[model samples]
Target: MLWVEKYRPKKLEDVVISKKLLDDILKWAREWDSHRKPLLLAGPPGTGKTSLALALASSLGWGTVELNASDQRSWPVISRIVGEGVFNETLSDEGEFLSSLEGKRKVIILDEVDNLHKKEDAGGEGALLKIIRKKPLQPMILIANDLFALSRDLRNHCKVVNFRRVDYRSIVKVLQRICKLEGIRAEKDALVLIAKNSAGDLRAAINDLQAAAEGKKKLTVEDVATTIRTQQTDIFKVIQKVFKSFDPEVYSMAMLLDETPDNIIWWVSENLPLEYEGDDLLKASLV
Candidate 1:
C-alpha cells in the first residue's frame, strides 16, 4: 500500500487540523442528524480535506460512499449511487450480526466538487442542489479546492468550512515521524526543505520524501535536492526568485535547472504577490 494511505489518519483527533476546527467538525458530526445543511470543506490541495471527512466518518462508526472526479458523476449517476447510498443503510448481514448496528448512518463524500461543472456532469449541479435542499437521510460532505466554483444555490444549501494551508513545520514533524516508522535516517534540513518546497502540500512532501529515500536507509539534503531538481523545478522557488531578484540570471538559472520558460512565466505571474508589495506587485505584473 502507498505510504500516504498507510499513514492516513483514522480518527478526527488524529488529523492535523486546528483544535477549534477539529472540535467544530466533531460537533457538526454530532449534530448532523438534528441539522440538515451539508458540510462543505473548501481548501487548497493536500490540506487533509478528504482525510478529515473519511476520518470523521470512521470515528463515528459510519460507512462512507465517496465519489470523485474519476467517477461518472452525472445526474443519473449521482441520483442512483449517492441517492441510494444516502437513503439505504449499508450494513450487511454479517456486519449486523457482529455489532449492534441499529440506526447506523452512512457518510456521502463528494470529492473534487469543483469539477462537477464538466460537460459530462451537465444537470448534475441541479440534481445535487435538489438533493441538498431535500435533506437526505444521511449526512453529506462536499470537498472542493475552490468554493466559488460551486453554484450560488448549491453554496447556499451547505455550511462552508475553510481549511487553510498547513504550516511547513507541522509537515516536517509528520515527515520525521514517518521516517522513524520506516527506519530511514533522514536529515532534518532535508525534511525541512521537502516540507518547504511542498508549499503546504503534505501529500507532495510525503511523495517527494518517498522518492528521495527509496532504496536508501539514509536521506540527506543532497539526495532530496538532486531528486527535486531531476523531477521538477519548484515553481514557488522560481516565482520567489523572479519577484525578489528580478535578475536576468534567475531565468538562466531556471533554464539550467530544467524549467521551461513558459512555466516559469506562469508561476511568476500567478504568485507575484507572495514576494512583492503593492506597487512592487503592480510593477512585477507589468513585466
Candidate 2:
C-alpha cells in the first residue's frame, strides 16, 4: 500500500511548484460560498491538480467527493444527488448539511470535466452551466488537462487557473525528500537523471524510483536504466491523434494506447500542431 500511494502528496505544500497559486487557493478555501464559481485547474498530469484539491479538503477537515468522467452523469443520478444537492452532498442521519459539517466546507472535485463531449440526460454541459452559474453551497473544483475543450458556455461561467509544468529542479528536490523518507541512498546524478527523464512529471519520477528501488534498497543510474523502460514510438502516433483528429473515438483511444500517460503527453506536446494550429493548438495546449 505504501509503495502504491507513497507518491501521493500529503499536503498542498507537498505538491511541486505553483506555490503562489496554492496560496491563492487556500484563501478561496477559507470562505467557500455558492458565489464561488467552480475553478478549473489546468496543467499537465502529475503536476498536482487533483492532489492539491484533495489536500485542501484534508487540511480543512472537510469531506471530499470525487467524480470521474467514467461515471454516468445521467439525469437521475445528477438530479437525485449532484444537481439537487449542490456539487453533490453527503447525507447523514442528522440531516443533509448544505456544506460538509465535517468541520470544514465540503469540497466537490470533478475530474476530467473536459470529457463532457457526449450528450447525456443529466444535462451534461447544460446542467453544469446551471450549477456553476448558481454557485452552489459547497465549494467545487474541476480538474482538466485541457481547459479549451470545456464548453464555451461552461468556460465562461467558471474561473480558470493556469498551471505550468513543474521544473526538473523542483521535481529533483521532491525526489530527494522522498528518498530521505524511504531511507534509501541515491546519488545526485542519479536523482537528476530521474527528474530530467521524468519530463516534469513527479508521478512518473516516483514510479521510476519505485521500480528501480525494488531490486536494491539504494538507487543508482544503473538501476534506473534497468528498471524504467523507454516508451515505444507507436505511442507517439496515437497521441498525434488526440490533437489532430476531431473524431471522438480518436480522443478516447489516444488516452489509453500502449503508452504511459507521461509518455503520451510528450507526443501530444510534440505533434499537437502537426494536426492543428492557432486556437486548436491553444486549446490543445491547455490540456
Candidate 3:
C-alpha cells in the first residue's frame, strides 16, 4: 500500500495543523445551527484540508457524508443533499447510535469546490449559492485548493478559512516518525532533503522516502539524491506557469518546483520583471 494512505491522520489532534485552526473548526461543529455558514477550508493541495475534515468528523463522533469533485459538481446531487438527508450511516465513532442524542448530526464535506468550472458544471455554482444563502441544515466543510477560484458570491456566503502550506520542519518531523515506525535507518539529512523537495507537501515527502528506502534497511543521501534527480522536472516550465497562469493555478504550479516553499518567493521575485511591467510589476512585487 502507498505510505500516504497507510499513515493518514485519523484524528483532528493527530493532524499536523495549528491548535487555533483546529479549535475554530471544532467550535463551528459544536455550535452548528441552521443560520451558521459552512466552513470553507481553502489552501494548496496536499495541505491536509480533506484529512482535517475527515478527522474533525471522527473526533466529534459524527458520521460523514463526503462529496467528491464529480458528485459535488452535479446539480441534482447538490440539490438533493441540501433538500433532504441522504446519509444512512448514523453510528458514532464509538459504534453507538448518535441520532437519538445529537439529532442525526453529521458533517457534510464538499471536496474540491474550487474546481467547479462553468459549462462543465453549469448549474452547480448556482445551486451551491442557493444552499449557502439559505439556512444551513447541517455542519458542512468545503475544501478548495484555490480560494480565489471560487465565485465571490460563494466566498461571501461561507466562512472562508485559509490554510498555509505545511512548513518543511513540521513535515520533517512527520517523516522522522514514519522512518522510525518503518524501522528504516535513514540519515536525517536525506530526510531533510526529501522534505525540501516536497515543497510543503507531506504526502509527497512520504512517497519520496518510501521510494528511496524501499527494500532497504539503511538509507543514505546518495540514494535519495539519485531518485530525486531522475524524477526532477524542468524548473523553467514551473516558472513559466507561475508567471503566466491564472491566479488559482499559480500556487499549484509553484508546488511543481523542486525548491522549498520559502525559496519559491525568491524565484518569483527574480522572474517578476520578465513577466509584468509598470503598475502590474509593482503590485505583484508587493504581493
Per-prediction TM-score, please? 0.76, 0.75, 0.74
Residue pairs in clash, model 3: none
Count of backbone collisions within predicted model 2: 4
The clash numbers for all candidates, in the given order, read 0, 4, 0
Give the alpha-carbon lDDT of every model.
Answer: 0.76, 0.69, 0.75
Q: What shift in Å separates residue 245 of candidate 2 from its native position after superposition?
A: 19
Candidate 2 local distance difference test against the native: 0.69
Better of 1 and 2 by lDDT: 1
Best by TM-score: 1
lDDT of 3 at 34: 35
The Cα error of candidate 3 at residue 119, in Å, is: 7.0
- Per-residue C-alpha lDDT of model 3 across residues 82-188, encoded as one tens digit per residue: 43432332435443334445655677788878867543233566667666666555677889877898888889888788888889999989988888999998899
**What does candidate 2's lDDT look like per residue over 1-287, in tens digits?**
44527667777667665667877787677655534777778877767788888888888876776777535544444444456556534543232544344434556688877766445346476667766676676667888877787777777776677787779899889888888888899987888888888777777777777767765668888777655444334465566555556777875776555345546666667776777789977987887
